[model samples]
Target: MKLARAIHFDESDMRVYASPARTGEWCISGGFEFSNWTEGDLTGKPRQAFANGWLGLETFGRATFVAVTALEPAELEALTDLLAEHFVTYYGAPSAEAARPVAQEEIGQMVELCEDHAPNTLLTVARELTESGVREAYRVIESSDAGLDQFAIHGSLDDEPHHH
Candidate 1:
């Protein structure tokens, strides 16, 4: 998905950081960046546009990991896994193997996997994005879900992160 070069953040204090858009992991960039954000938080409906069934993740402070993104619960979950898999893919098998493999068949295990991998995935994404350049980083992180691109943050989503 494509986005305006100038990313709009709801929070006045939010900042932008750069990270490279690498191959094999590019598919997970959108979600990974949003999930691994350090300087900001996430806000939902009635506040930042989640009322439309789309969630937003915004950046905060003078240094930001991700600016903002609006996505569905399903897409969030899917992207969570994608980020995890990307973690495993980039970091090799040892670390990922230690984090518990994603059990695709069992809903319960899947939930657990998401819980377990979120932190690691975020860290991994953050590390990679550190040198990717804000413009390219934000550009790639516009949307993870196909057909659901182009979202705006009318308010701050970088103060607190939440789960739907």
Candidate 2:
């Protein structure tokens, strides 16, 4: 399988590319490195929303992705509203709750718990936690392909986790 990569700087900027996959579709994937967590830097941008310690949407195909950072509750609420708008626009009204930014600390605890498990296993656990609006808000967008699936979430990893 071929993978396409894209990076967004801050909240206002976004860039996407098509990969060698047969569908020629753009996939969304990203990770948060929360070495620096500050309120001013995160809330300065109009489109930016901080959850734990990272900024920007970790999205794919203009649909599903994660937003992890250390944002205030008000900021997270605003970001969730924005994500809902996007979800309605792209995915035809989310059957699930709209995406919301999650705190970096919550993500840290989850990762620590999964330290001994495989990466995919950890992802499954995290997905379960974010499903149906317990606390962390996440949306899973279905891909065009019949056999392939993509996932996105918002959180910070002390280090960049390798993607297989």
Each prediction's TM-score against the native?
0.25, 0.24
Provide the lowest-lDDT 10-residue window in model 2. 120-129
- Candidate 2 displacement at residue 133 in angstroms: 21
Sum up the clashes in candidate 2: 14
For each candidate, the alpha-carbon lDDT, in order, equals: 0.28, 0.28
Q: Give the per-residue lDDT digits (tens) of candidate 1, residues 46-93.
A: 112111111111211112222222234675455445544544665454
Question: RMSD for each model, in Å, please?
Answer: 15.8, 17.2
The TM-score obtained by model 2 is 0.24
| Cα deviation of 66, candidate 1, in Å | 3.3
**C-alpha RMSD in Å of predicted model 2 compared with the true structure:** 17.2
Instruction: Give candidate 1 misplaced runs (Cα > 4 Å).
Output: 1-65, 94-164
TM-score of candidate 1 to 2 decimals: 0.25
